[model samples]
Target: MSHRAALGTLAIGGNPLVSRRVLSSVGEWGGARVGARGAGLSTSMASAEELRLVARIATGDEAALRQLYARYGSLVYSIAVRVTGDRCAAEDVAQQVFIRVWERPAGFDPERGSLRTWLATLAHSRAVDHVRREQACHRREQRQLPGAPSDVEEVATSSAVAERVGRAVDALPDDQRVAVLLAYYDARTYREVAAELDIPEGTAKSRLRLGLRRIARCLEQEGLGAWT
Candidate 1:
């Protein structure tokens, strides 16, 4: 069975995604079967409030941690997936976020941000770390590979977002764009980016500042200022 189907089956008592198949298959599970009733319940899959559970988790409540996962598992998973672009890595990032939350609940200062936002930050950081590590490994492999330049060009021409980013990157005034891509997209440290670009650290700082300001202005002029 598909993962979603298996997840739905395990969630039979709690999930709202139940289908007629589940209704019919109920009796097949023997003692676990209920009345085989099929009245649609208007209940949300996100049945618990994440903040409240997080609060309880702060006090070392294990059940609250489980409830928090049930409430926000998909949200956390989604952020990791989007950031990492790898299912296995996303799963690992999601697991790590929760593990950290469980181990040091007091580390979460709700005053800094909402539980959801904090979780997103954690997911993003983990994904960024993974991406950087992968990039470093790729750089090493590229050094050993011959005729890799042709593959890079073909890959750049293949995707819409990649093409758009390529244009934006091309438009950038060398230094600014290099730093922006290095720090933001490659997820490298500003100091590291500066070192890689063969420029002073302050120059890297200036590049990021100028690049971001330009991007903000351009996006705003295009009526995407809300994202800025």
Candidate 2:
């Protein structure tokens, strides 16, 4: 796959182009878990208020956008930082998150969860995309070397391993997938994942552990053992 195409298939996929897919996946997953998870966010009852703000923003209300930012800006920035590990990248991710919200406030569904959690999810996804792009650039530069047989072999092996891992992650159940994504890719702790997902700590740990074990088995079956 081309580097552009591989973004969506990889675990590190993140970019405005793929944000809709990530949002849709997380929104659907959140909707499904509502009854079982009961608003896996810090503030359960604030979604209604947030929904009003989103509706206002949807109608070209700039003040509403500012208000929404005021409430969750810090949270969004922190999530970006966790995923990108650089202040500049985090700032860019934060900007993308707000720009996305301004352009499509309806994307944040009150039924799925609070605006905070939804935006945070988007922020993390975008940050991951930035990291992926940087890594891809580095890969491209390394591939420019002339007649490096071992480097070519290593790159091919790495790509195959990444593809296998991505497929395995894609096959995971929604809840487990989100937990693993947040915990492993987003650099969130189990406690943070549980808090963000509005589940108990023990449940978060269980899902991550079980999900990772399944991924390992899948990778091993696929003859990808570096991680497994």
> TM-scores, in order shown?
0.47, 0.47
Per-residue lDDT of 1-228 in model 1, one digit per residue for the tens?
332344343433322232223222322222221221110021121224445666777666656665556544555665566555566666666655666676566776655555655776787787788777878777643222112222323453443333543455556776787677656534667897777778899988989998877765664465433311
The local distance difference test score of each candidate is 0.54, 0.61
List the candidate 1 regions with Cα displacement exceeding 4 Å.
Answer: 1-51, 59-63, 70-75, 132-182, 195-200, 209-228
Which pairs of residues collide in model 1?
none
lDDT of 1 at 209: 90
Model 2 residue 178 distance off true place after TM-score fit, in angstroms: 15
**Candidate of highest TM-score:** 2
